[model samples]
Target chain A: MSKGKIYLIPTTLGDSPINDVLPPKTIDILSQLQHFAVENIRTTRRYIKKVIPEKDINQITFHLLNKHTSISEIRHILQSVEQGIDLGIISEAGNPCIADPGSLLTREAHRNNLQIIPLTGPSSILLALISSGMNGQNFAFNGYLPISPQERIKKLRQLEKKSQSEQQPQIFMETPYRNKQMIESIIKTCHPETLLCIATNLTLSNEFIKTAPISYWKKHIPEIHKQPCIFIIGA
Target chain B: MSKGKIYLIPTTLGDSPINDVLPPKTIDILSQLQHFAVENIRTTRRYIKKVIPEKDINQITFHLLNKHTSISEIRHILQSVEQGIDLGIISEAGNPCIADPGSLLTREAHRNNLQIIPLTGPSSILLALISSGMNGQNFAFNGYLPISPQERIKKLRQLEKKSQSEQQPQIFMETPYRNKQMIESIIKTCHPETLLCIATNLTLSNEFIKTAPISYWKKHIPEIHKQPCIFIIGA
Candidate 1:
């Protein structure tokens, strides 16, 4: 029997409307699939219901794939595909495999010669980069920064230096509650002329996406505590 | 009068259907905008008609922003926004600003304090990365590698070393016709055990996406000549 293809489905970021963020065909594909490997079961089920109100939640089988999911469990999920049952990886927000545990399953899919299809949808990292007016041609995503203050400051300096040398934009995110501290570290560790873009509340109402020099950010301190943010440092 | 915002619009990759790659709201947004800064006027008009066949093409004003477009011309496009006329940037394919000159206009928009809205859509780079199942948590998009054979080999060596040291995946592309030569350089320059992913014709019917070690690729050289491709090197 031919194996089922693994679809890497993308979810909306924050509270953005489904229609506004996802293609119509994404909904169509989701309704047809009966199995999913999701990060958060509650959010994924709710999202599925919200997008396709008529979809029967009871008919679907979801496999948990959070921090605690084991390799054997992921292998089992792939085994279901080996039985010709297609499965999808759904993240709580944004595209799967990006800043999520979905990559573990995707890597396995590649290892086992499973076909992987990545759908088009909202990605805060990509959205933030284009909107920042920074160097999009060459950029790096370093995921979240070091939580320790000293290490975070050192990392910020290294990022700034690399950006200057390579002429490439550096992208990094922070824990929601620690966003304010992240901004301060960026402002203090980088030169005054270095550009810093702070993109917060993406894809939601009252979104704030702006890029300015460190000096300007220092003079006008932003109130972004508790808000999810993507920071980019540019030469 | 309030300042008109700049919208960063995305176009479909290859011959993929519009509905499959873009949200319905994107079409709605494009039809409402009267001015566009595009990489190619002919292709943009053709794509606009293909997506919204009922819309009147005569009402739209297209500003040329290709290789010959000067800084002064891009500045004029932004100036139109000063008159409260909203404008959109449309690339030849995929999202604007990445691997295109659209960012020059976007950078000026940021300097002038114009609000920029980047719509979510098909980004080949992001799609390739997600589908590759590599280290999406930390990766870099380095645009295109050096075209010269010697420089290309040296660059591949450097990329492989960086991927090994930083444990970060490096992504780069090549002109369509030179894809075969690029693969040859990668196979010859990198270590046998290094992982490489070749994603070609993404979001199309005959899409080919796979990842394997350099040794495997050497044994099975891909016939990706004249096909647009994204190459990724992982540790």
Candidate 2:
């Protein structure tokens, strides 16, 4: 029997309408799948219900695959797929296997030689970069910066230097609750003339995406506490 | 009057059905817009018609914004938007302002303080990375490699080293026509153990996305001449 395919599904960025981010076909596919490896089972169940309310939640099986999931357990999750049972990988939000632990299962799928399909949807990282008015051709997504004050400052300086020298924008994210601290560091560590873009609550009703010189941002920092955000710095 | 918003529109990767990649709301927005800043007028026109066939081709105004477009001309394209006329930016394929010259106008939009909205859609780069089973948390998209053979080889070596040392996947593309040459260089230059993923014809009927070590790829190289492809390297 042919190995089952793995679909890399994308969820809405926040509470945005599913119609605004996901295609109808993606929904159709979601309705058909009976198994999933999700970052958070509760959130995934809620998201699936939001998209396809008619979906029988109890009919579906969820395999946990978050940061805490062990490597050995990941291999076991693919056993169903190896036996010709198609599976879907869903993240807590946005696309799976991206800055999320879904990669662990996806990597295992490859080892088992299962085909992988990625559906179209909103990607906050790409959305932020395109709207930042900065270099998009060449950019680096550093995921999250170091937590320590000194290391974060050093990393920020290094990113600023690379942005200026290579004409490449440096993109990164911070823990939502630490958004304020991240902005504080960005303003204090980077050159005044550097351009910084703060994209918060993307694709949501209260979305705020803007770019300005660091000096200007220092004078007008927006409150982004407990809000998902993506930052980009460029010269 | 409030400045008009700039919508970053996404086009199909190939001749795939629009319903497969773009949301219905995106189509509704496309149907309502009368102005667009596009990479290729002909292809953009074709895409618009495919999405909303009821749209009157003669009623819409198209502003060219490809590599050949002068910097000064990009500013002129946003004049209508500045006057409160909503505008959409479309690329030949995939998302605009990303590895595309649409950024020139997007930058101008920010300078003019126009709201920029990026609709959700397929991004081959992001799609390839998510499906590659490689490191997705931290990755760099180096748009294209150097054309010169020596420089190309050197860049490949650098990318491989980065992939192994940092576990950060390196993604880059090649001119469709030069796809074969790019693969030849990858097989001939990088270490036999280095993993390389070549994702081609994404979101299309005949899409092929796979990852394997350089040694395995050397023994079985797929024909990708004149095909749009994204290549990723990781440990």
Per residue, candidate 1 scores C-alpha lDDT tens digits across A10-120 of 988887888788997777788889999999999999999888899999999999987688889899999999889988889978999888888888888888998988889
RMSD of 1: 1.1
Measured against the true two-chain complex, the DockQ scores of the candidates, in the order shown, are 0.82, 0.83
Q: Model 2, A151-204: lDDT tens per residue?
A: 999999999999999898999999999999999999999989999999999999
Model 2: per-residue lDDT, tens digit, B1-235?
A: 8778899898889999988989988888999999988888898888888899888999999988888998778778777788888999999778898888888887777777889998888899999999999877899899989999999999999999988887889999999999999999999999898889999999999999988899999999999999999999999
On lDDT, the candidate that comes out on top is 2
Clashing pairs in 2: none
Candidate 2 whole-model C-alpha lDDT, 0 to 1: 0.90
Docking class of 2: high
Clashing pairs in 1: none
> Candidate 1 chain A: minimum summed lDDT over ten consecutive residues — where?
A19-28
- Scored against the native two-chain complex, candidate 2 gets a DockQ of 0.83
